[model samples]
Target: MDCDLLIIGGGVNGCGIARDAAGRGLKVLLVEQDDLAGHTSSASTKLIHGGLRYLEYYEFRLVREALIEREKLLHIAPHIIWPLRFVMPMPPTGRPGWMIRLGLFLYDHLGGRGSLPGSRGVPLNGPFGAGIKPDIARGFAYSDCWVEDSRLVVLNALDARERGADIRTRTRFTGAARDAEGWIATIAGEDGERTVRARAIVNAAGPWVDHVVGAARGAHPERPPRLVKGSHIIVPRLFDGEHAYILQNLDKRIAFAIPYERDFTLIGTTDVPWHDDPAAPAISVEETAYLCASVSRYFAKPVNPEDVVHSYSGVRPLFDDGSTSASAVTRDYVLKLGEENGPQILSVFGGKITTYRRLAEHALEKLAPFLPPMGEPWTDREPLPGGDVGDFELLLSEIRRRWPFLSERTSWRLARAYGSRVNRVLRDATSLAELGEDLGGGLHTREVDYLVTQEWARTADDILWRRSKLLLHVPPGTRERLERYLAR
Candidate 1:
């Protein structure tokens, strides 16, 4: 097979590049060794906002770009991305009240705040104060967004596929060699090894960026990515409202306690220096204790290690800028373009989900000389797959109206997950029975079929974890049942 661009790694960066390039009329081929977003992309804090913490590091350009992208993304994918108000509890000794206010002012004005609301002072003594201790009386609230992170990757891949890009998850780009004409990539899938040629190659292999670069010829870059491990824990809901809380730790690191999966609260992300395998990193007992302690400081109800129901850890492929602290490392991406004469390779290093689209746009521009003269950049205003609906609630209402038999929970799930594509899954199925077998935990045959057929889901984990986040809610036997069904 031959294409204009071949992307390695199916994370946000790779998928985003594929979507953008394909939209610009480039024949794109993307291959991932494991499931799409099987690593860092899925295990994020899942926030779309300017890195408020980065202000201390003077990352003004990075923060401003991310903030602008946040609003643009929310507009394009309203179903998957919505405004989230983050409540930050102020500590007297932390940064001083004046500094906090000044930071919020900068955050609000840094980017042109479009549809999302700006920051404001809120009294923590009221309903939001229930979980808080008496010392912290007031805090500031700022607007960001919550994204279905993994789903965002899938939707981008889906859009890329619809636009004639080949997105092959579970396929590895084992090796590649460049010639005068193009790069010949050795792709290994379940079927076996095959060769695909492309004029240019995009190495967006999140954590394994260096590993992928070795496939060609030259040694890795002088400044490689320092692997930083960030872990999150899921416990029973800590606070009541739909809002999330950003807790400040004694170490000056920030942790988020966001409402997740309806019944649970997602607390996370300890930035620890990591050197272990990037493919799979387990949360240490100490890290769990740290997260629990971080949230316990702010909430009225204390959280212990035992309270954690589920936890996840991922290694961020951050560009090593010689920052002493892992938290201090910049989240801004570094796109290094390869040889000027030979088949080009653009290696992406260090990026957050909030800036993936802009990163994609930049990636294409970097490779513009090698690529064919194609369409203009068009991903900005265009919606991702199933994001054409005006609003999430309106789409949910439409689902319920069309299928009155669907319970509120079911409709809401379908509307949020499938977005405007809900009708495609619900096609011709008038009643619950017609929707087919229940594999347990609200997942039905209709939805499973849609995922398997349309979304390139080959395993139960793809549907359960990345596609829908039903992994936490599903029963013990849910995986087995889904696996058995797939086998047939």
Candidate 2:
């Protein structure tokens, strides 16, 4: 396949770049070694916040950029992105209330605060204290956004595909060589290997960034990425309120317990030095214990490893900024344009989900010298696939109205997952029976077919876990049945 750009990796950054590049009228081909968001992208804190903790490290630029993008992202993908309130309780051992107040002030006003609410003091004696200990009385409430992180990646890839980009998941970018004219790339997939030429290449390989660059250029980065593993554990709901909590750990780091899936409290995230493989980072015993203790410190009911129903871990390929602590490293991204080689290859190092769009804009700007002049940045105005509906609650109401046969639960799920595309998925199905076989996990054969044909889902894992968190809702037999249906 001859293309203007060949993008490696199917994580958020890679897909986001592809969507942007394709929108600009570039012939784009994105190859992912595994499923889209098979790794780090799927295992996020599921937050689109400006990293309030990064302020302490004096990462003002990163915070501002992320905060600005937070509102913009919410506007474009309102179906998957919604406003979330975070309550940070003050404790006797943690940072003083005044210090936190100062930080909140900066966080509230740092970037241009848009539709989302700003920071304010909240009395924990009320409903906010549902699971918190009585000793913690007052704290700060702030605004951020929650995202179905993996779904966000899929939507971007879908948009890219629609905009004339060939997005191939389960396909590996083996190697590439630059010559006097453009470059040649070797890709291997189920159908085997083939060579393609492109005018330029984008190495957005996330954790395996340096690995991809090394395979192609035969040179290692002078500064290797510091792989930091972040882990999260899910447990039964801790509080009845919709708001989430951000608790400060004794080690001065912060952890969060967010309300997830209507029935579970998603608590986590421990940052630890990772030396093991990035492909399969697992939550260590120590990490789980630490996360349990982190939330237990503030809540009345102690959360231990026993309470954890599910856990996951992912390694972040952060730029080695000489930071001693894993959590303190910069979340900023860098675009390295390869010169002296034949065709220019841009290798991306270190990026956060919130900044992926801007990173793509910057990436394409870096490649301007090699490719033909493309159109202006248009992603800022375009919505991702199934994200045209701006008002989520209204969208849900509309879905219920249009499909009177849909149950409230299913309507809510479909609205959140597919947004306006719910109409396309349910097509002509006036009854549940017409939607095909129920997979016993709130998953129907219809949804599975949509996932397979439209969303690039190959296995049960792609649908149950990444495309949707039905894994938490599905029974053990759900996967086998779903896979059986896919086989046909």
Candidate 3:
């Protein structure tokens, strides 16, 4: 096979680049060893915000760019992305209140404030104090966004495919050799090994970037990524409102208690240096204790280790800048283009989910000099697939009206998941029975078929976990039934 660009990873950066490159008139092919967003990209705190804590590290440029992209992304993908208000209580011990206020001020104005409301101080006593301790008096509230993180990756890959890019999941890019003309790469899949030619390659392999680099050559790069493990624990909902809390831990790191899956509170994310296999990173006992203690300090109810219902950990591949601590490492991306002689290759390192779009644009610019003249930048102005719906609430209302048989929860779930494409899932079905068998948690066979046919879902986990968080709500035998159905 022949292509213009061969991308090796199915995470946000790789899928984002494929979307951009394919739209720019390039023949793009992306191969992933696992499912799309099977790793780091799916394992975020699921926020699209200018990292508030990053301002403390003087990451002004990074914060500004993220703030700018925050609005752009909300505009382009409103179905899976929407505004989220973060309530930050002024910690009695951490950075003084004045310092936090200054940081919030910068965060509010940095990226040119958009439709979202700005920051303001409020007493942590009334509605804001619902689950808070009595001692903490006041804090600030600011706007960010909540994203269906994995869905974002799938949508990008879907858009890329619609625009002529070939996205091959469960396909591995084993190795590549560069020559004067281009790259001769070998990819392995269920069918076996195959060789393909490409004008260039993009290594966006997330945690395995250095490993991929080694596969291209015989040795690892001089500077490998500093693997920082970030872990999150999900507990039963701690508070009532749609808003989330950003608590400051005594150790200076922050933990968030966000409402998740409607019935659970998602708490997380400790920055611990990791050295083990990146493929399977699990939260340690110490990390779990740390998270529970961190949130316990703020909420009136203390969280214990036993309270955790589920937990996940992802290893971030940060560019080694020699930072003293994992928390201090920069979240900014660095694109390292190969030496200017042979077939061009670009490696991406250390980027946040909020900045993936910008990183994709930058990646293409770096590769532009080596490849054919491509189209101008266009992702910013266009909407991703199914995001063309003008108003989300209006779309939800229409879906409910069209299918009064659907419960409010199901209607909202379908509208949020498929957006304008919900019609395709519903088809001409006038009743729930017509939609096909109820697998579990209202996930019907019809929708599963849509996911399998339209979204490249090959397994039950792809539908339950990554494509949607139905795993948390589905019955115990849901997976087994779905698996059996897929087999048939």
Candidate 4:
């Protein structure tokens, strides 16, 4: 096979670049070792916002760019990306109220925010925060956006595929060598090994970037990606509203407690350095205790380690800034194009899900010299697959009306997960029996089939975890049954 671009890693950065490049009329091929977003891309706090705390690090440029992208993304993907308010309950000991207010003010005005609301002062002692302890007196509420991170990656790849790009999942790029004309690359999939030719290669392998450059493709030794491990814990919902909370710890680090999967609250993200391989990163017991203790400080109902139902960890492939502290490392991506070789390899280091689109645009800008004359940036204005719903509420109502037999909760789930694509997923099915066999926990065989055929779901975990959060809803025995079915 031959293409203009051969991208390794199906994470957000790789898929985003593939989508942008393919839209610009470049022949693109993307290969992932596992499933798309089976790694760090899916394991995130899942917020699409300007990094509020990065202000302390003087990352004004990054903050501003991310803030602007937030609104743009929300507009393009209203079904998956929507406005989320965050409540920062002022702690008496941490940064003073004035300082918090100043940061919130800068956050509001730094970007040219149009659709999302700006920050507002919330009385620390009011009913909105009535559950808070007496020590926390004042707070600030600001706007941000939330996303199903894995879905974002899949949608990008899906859009790329729609635009004549070949997406090969569970395929590994074993090695690549630069020749006089282009790059000769070898890839391994379940069937066998194959070779491909490409003018350029993209190493957006997240935590495996350096490994890919040094070991896989034999590129020049360049800046290494700093591996920072972050973790999140899921527990029973603590609050009723859609708004999330950003709580400060004694160590000055911030933790997020956001509404997740309907009945659960997702809290986490402790930034700690790790020297181990990225593929095996897991949450430590100490990390779990630390997160629970941090949230326990302010909430009326304290969270203990036992309360955690699920925990996940990811390693951030951050660009090394020579900073000793992991939290101080920048989240901004660095795109390095090799000067020695004509077969250009663009490596992305350090990025968040919130800024993946802009990261994609920047990657193309670096590769413009090598690329054929292509169209200007167009993703910002275009909607992702199933994201074309003009009004989310109206779409939900229509789904409920069409599937009057479906419970309100089930209809909402389908709408949120499939977006406008729900129509196709449920096509020609009228009654519950027509939907096919019940796999238990509101999961039917029809939905699983849709995921497998449409969303590239190969295993039960892909459907349970990434494509949907049905793992949280299903009973243990049902999950076992699904696993057995997939194994067969």
lDDT of each: 0.89, 0.89, 0.92, 0.88
When 2 and 4 are scored with TM-score, the better candidate is 2
lDDT digits (tens) for residues 1-488 of candidate 1: 39999999899999999999999999999999998889999999999989999898899999999999998999889889988888888867566778889998999999975787888888998866657887899988988999999999999999999999999978988888888888888999989999999999999998899888888653235466899999999998877888999888898888999999899999989888888789879999999999988888777789999999999999999998888888888889999877667778999999999999999999999899888998888998999988999967777877888899987777888889889988899897889999888888789988999899898888998899889988887878999999999999
Taking all chains together, the TM-score of candidate 3 against the true structure is 0.98
Tens-place lDDT per residue, model 3, 1-488, is 39999999999999999999999999999999999999999999999989999998999999999999999999999999999989998867877988888999999999996899999998998887669998999988999999999999999999999999999999998898887788899999989999999988999999999988988852225499999999999999999889999989887888898999899999988999999999999999999999999999988899999999889999999999999999999999999987667678899999999999999999999999878789999999799888999999999999989999998888989999999989999998999999899999999999999999999898987999899999888888999999999999
lDDT of 1 at 170: 83
Off by over 4 Å in 2: 218-220
Q: Mind giving the per-residue lDDT tens digits that candidate 2 earns over 269-368?
A: 8888888789989998999999988988888999989989999999899889898988888889978887654688888888889999999999999898
TM values, all candidates = 0.98, 0.98, 0.98, 0.97
Work out candidate 4's RMSD over C-alphas: 1.4
The per-residue C-alpha lDDT of model 3 at residue 28 equals 98
lDDT (C-alpha) at residue 335 in model 3: 93
Which of the numbered candidates is closest to the native, going by highest lDDT?
A: 3
Worst 10 residues of 2 by lDDT: 215-224
Q: For candidate 4, list the clashing residue pairs, or say none.
A: none
TM-score of 1: 0.98
C-alpha lDDT (0 to 100) for residue 410 of candidate 4: 83
Q: For model 3, where is the 10-residue window of minimal lDDT?
A: 213-222
lDDT of 4 by residue, 1-488 (tens): 39999999999999999999999999999999998899899899999989999999999999999998988889888888888889998876889878888998899999975787888889867655845787777788988999989999999999999999999989988888888777899999999999999988899988889878985454656877889999999999997778889999999899999989889999989998989978888999999999999999989899999999999898999999899889999899888887564768888999878889999999888888876788899999999998999999999999988888788878888888878989888887889889886787778888887777777888888988988788888876777777776666
